[model samples]
Target: MSYAEHFSLKNIPYGIASTQDRPAAVATRLHDLIFFLSDLNLDSPATLNALASIDKDELVKLRRTLQTALGDEKNVSRFGIPVGEATMHLPIEVKGFTDFSCSTEHLLNAGEAVLGVRSFPPASLHLPIGYTGRSSSIVVSGTPITRPYGQYRDGEEIGFGPSRAVDYELEMGAIIGKPSTFGDRVSVNDADEHIFGVVIVNDWSARDIQGFEMQPLGPMNGKSFGTSISPWVVTLEALEPFATEPPAKKTPVKAYLQDNKIKSSYSITLNAEVLSEGSATEVCKAQLQWMYWTFRSLVAQQTINGCNVNTGDILGTGTVSGVGDDEHGCLLEMTKGGKVEWELSTGKKRRYLEDGDGVRLTAYAGDGVGFGECTGVISAAKPF
Candidate 1:
């Protein structure tokens, strides 16, 4: 399909969430047509009072309807809703979406910084490296991210306190629609079949907390506190036009990570911006195609262990960094593990996130399938 013909304004993403106006709502967009699952229920008195007011019953019904609509091309349109008529309270909704760390490049870079070496243990490379993160901590864009308090120790001293070095990770996230049981291995060819949609994910980090606890096992307090994602979930079907081959690997992957054929990595452009108190500035711009691994590989490896994945489970394509200096994904890398300073346009410099700092991440795939933006502003740790 031609680029112009593929992406049209009508193709807004779908997501299940609550807004200030309608606490429980299922929203979909087709150009200016905003349809809430609630709108389908014309029988509610609230529906008659305001065509856009989404109630609990409407959301539950929509969820049931969409669950059945997935995987059937004929029923796909049944999930779409107009954007113009969407409720006014929609913008104020609190977003809840989980993220995963599935990128090989991101893992390697982070390891090199802390471990003083490149690459990871052979087991990590051979297997799909991942960890389960908190989904309840997921918040919508523009929400304030509080610096978390956790266990910290430097050298001989260990204590419980607030994070001293807060940080941000630029990542892309995928939303699962259908679920599979334990012991079921999914193939790359069928990976997309199980996927529901995509969203921008910000896996916030407490560098100080991570630095202290990440040994033997992976992240615990370093990750669980809070993670943020965009409110909109652009469907995989919409992103087909932008698909491109995943990055060439430096080494062969294990049998489980291998793909029958090369697949597209979605030619999307990603950017990050920093906003200090009273000021906002763009930090970096990179491409989604730069990923060293594919989302399909991540999903495939996840289920190889026979572990079952649920519908709301999220996977983050770790910080998507490239070879160039400007392409680095987090303040840790951009500043070379805090050894250098990241100079911003406002003439400010940062080694790590500070109190009252806001970080914004955005991505756009081709012309039509844009994932919009996901942002999180930092708040100082609560006084001890």
Candidate 2:
């Protein structure tokens, strides 16, 4: 579906983090509001208990005085604390985020483009594939991302340095609320009950660093550097109307991963835009929709190994790329390993991202449930 028809300003996504100006705030497009649970000066313990049970709305408003102070730019004096004081750090206490590799088109394209293979790994066809990523690196959108430094090897020998190939992966992420134990494997039918909401995730990549290290095992430091996510978490209940079937499987799947009652995916439009330093032009626009596996399958398969998952654990959908020329997820694929060039609207060309380039990834469910935006700007690598 077209973007304008589906997304709107009222539907802000939620995220948990400490901003530079306000150490802990509920980020929305209009402004960030500081939430102080301990200092509300409740009439009684029951009032505080009642506040805790009132949901995110009541909790946001109980602290409106803080909001007023923040709005008037007098928060430091009003609270008798530092201007950006945060009594507590943001944690997974509210929601758990997870990444899933459900996009078959992206997996296939990336394999062919990066590994010179035309098909998916046989293991992926039968089950949803995923890996655990660092939740600590997950930052609120609009945060400045520092380029990660790691080891690299272009010619069989490993050496340490700042990454030469940094890229962005366009994907959706899910928030987990209900937890499960190590011995419990949720059936596909019951997966949605464990989910709380969804958010846009920019799983930043250091392709060159990853290429050198990702053999024998999967991504490590290459993927651990940082992950950018939208602040607002859009609830699953809000997205119920947009459920749709995922692309048909080219190969057969195991019974445990299939769900007759639930459709596997949503027909959401995903796009990525890059802004280079000193340029007013939008560098790229990539759409998302051609995924192989659905979010439900990923959740079901995650527990197959008897691994327990908690409320805030994140599962990232790997980069969602399509078959068209403008749909590639990263520059590595768009430029075909830098063997081709991408023409921007400004008439300039790019093979890969340069320092100071800002990348933004956005997505929304077809029925108007917007997941908001995930964005990060690349800074120059620390001087060697």
Candidate 3:
């Protein structure tokens, strides 16, 4: 099927692809074929950073030209390669990654699951709560995550070993397209122009390590290990058709954080599944609209203090969980902090991920306009 019949040509997303004869190049997907933008003689750069730095109108024009080219058989045959024959690489050279706890349902579920309560911190209602993560460890999807070795307390015995409570967090990552000066404040109204696109993110977690290390300080070694993102970047323009109003907040935010002009959330649905011993079982289903804060809100909060943000910087919506237990986004919340065991496809029970278990997260809007799969498998930890 052609791109038009299968999906909206407007859904053209960008990525990095390589073949046996070709080195890695910036590419775009149409149906099952990948086309290198550099082949189009459009002054395409080698990396997404340069593309992101261009004017928004220029980006739109490039996309439109590509769409027009797709209609020509000669253009398809000249520059397109079967996607299966190519290897996908990390799409962006990330400089920084910030993850925010933006789902109220996720917070409430976590409080009830871990602490026998159902409430959130007061500060969360006012602004997005987030943490700066190690961007160096962010890998493209399909990269195997080695279970990290770290310290954990087991019945008063603090021991160090490969983490027993490894988990996956389903999230959506916003890619920064524009730069901000160190002293400039970006209001919520301007956040859209600064963001280039969205990608599926799997912010892998080591729950036992996090529990042992997170006391006065927040997540450190537990979270710094690995994060996975889907190869394709679905630009914001492609998602505008699916944009919807964010849930109305009961508590009002400050004037600077308010969004009065634009719909900030998308009606995207996400699903997480585990592949064990060749069998795959669906684990969770979530909605991106469940988040309490919007992407605009996060961008404004990050810059309100005069913190500069540059192209390729990422902001992640942490664990996009919904209202039900089955909709919980991670093993820590799904298994009730290891107190309960979830049954997998192989008839095995797990409170957390086991070595060789693969996890896949997928997301989409109406008629399968989607962010491609974000997947990772667990491997045994290396010797100390």
Candidate 4:
């Protein structure tokens, strides 16, 4: 009955796993063992998305079944699938992925440097701003992030090359489990019924590439390179103990987003590090409390437009930055867009990541680690 808080008997989070000879199957973790859902007569599960599309009642029933099976001493051996022999795959099949801007601190800090403005557009004050990200580019943790190449504006001269400013953004993604029909809307209070869990996301960015192409609409090649995510999906019900009120809103949102009265945040603590040239540097630590738009509210806003949300759709909370310099979420904010070199504990300093720099991020809530580390090392860009 005992396991880490992240994946305990009470928290049977789902994911996809496989051994060399076995096909991909749905699974839940209690400790070292991965309880394969297929063995429970939930056979041949290709992915968690199949279960995600089921009704809320069914989802609850399955969760409870896993919880009960793991709790019973007699059922333990049968459910204990060897986790060491398995490989964890992406938890869900992301049919649609949306990246939302939720941290005012990020906008404020990044805007000044990237856009030469003190604030984001006025639209940010009213509704959640998001862009459809490349679903195909979303890779699991441990994947390498190849530096992207695109046309860059070099003082009015257009040049195509690899980005000089590569950065990592610390964020949490809400995994949508329940399906909603087109034109259906959800309130902030009911959003949880649709959200299966949370996962750590590292939305890698290439400043030079993003900067040049983001003007006409939103990001393009700069963002499509690669985004990394942790393997486990920690259910919200398990995180209920960590729930806390969001910060006092400095800017008010619209009607649908305010249904919860601003109590929709979690107390998860997030941190990022860089392993470069044999030196590991602790970059920043931030909490989800600093997020301007809570996950529930973000869901309400997304569906408010009458857009149908699929079972595996992921709503990403953009860079969760806090108030202090030590709490910045991305290197752009911490270094002021590469204008300042941040000192590392190893006596080295960096303005941006160089080749071979491995970026790893982790989040925690109490003693247990949040969604395992979402890691990606930088590789030199492909040839132009």
Please list the C-alpha lDDT of all candidates, in the order they appear: 0.65, 0.63, 0.88, 0.82
Instruction: Please estimate how well model 2 matches the true structure, expressed as its whole-model Cα lDDT.
Output: 0.63
Worst 10 residues of 1 by lDDT: 44-53
Residue-level lDDT of model 4, residues 1-384, one tens digit each, is: 123455557667788888887787888887677877877665434768877777778777777777877887766687677667788888888888899999988889999878778877778867778898988989888888898888777877988888889999999999898878899898888998899888899999998889888987999788889988888888887777788887776776667878654457889989888887677788889999878788898789888879988888889999989889888889999988789998766777789888899888888775443565788999998884
Model 1 gets an lDDT of: 0.65
Model 4: clashing residue pairs? none
**Alpha-carbon runs more than 4 Å astray in model 1:** 1-10, 17-23, 30-33, 37-104
Off by over 4 Å in 3: 1-8
Highest lDDT: which candidate? Answer: 3
lDDT of 2 by residue, 1-384 (tens): 123333332333333434355445333221223333233333312221122233444434433433453344444234333213323222234333455666666677678768888787768878877776777777767777778788887577787778878888877776665677879898877877666566778888888788778796778788878888765566565566667767778778888877785455766777788877545444335443467776677778888877766766566678777777777777777766656777665677777667788887777675446755677798877776
| Native-to-model Cα distance after best TM-score fit, residue 276 in candidate 2, in Å | 1.3
Candidate 4 ranges with C-alpha deviation above 4 Å: 1-5, 40-45, 73-82, 367-369
lDDT per residue (tens digit) for residues 1-384 in model 1: 012222245234664444445555555544333445455542432221122133334534544454444334443455443332333222222222334444566666777777768776666555555666766677766678888999887668887878877888888876655566777877766777656667787888887788888787767788777777776677666677778887677667777777775664677788888887667776667787877667777678767777665665676787877777777788777766667777666788888888888898888886656765677888878886
- Candidate 4's displacement at residue 297, Å, is 1.4
- The weakest ten consecutive residues by lDDT in model 3 span 1-10
Between candidates 2 and 4, name the one with more favorable lDDT.
Answer: 4
Candidate achieving higher lDDT, 1 or 2: 1
Candidate 2: list runs displaced more than 4 Å: 1-98, 155-159, 278-289, 366-368
- Which numbered prediction scores highest in TM-score against the true structure? 3
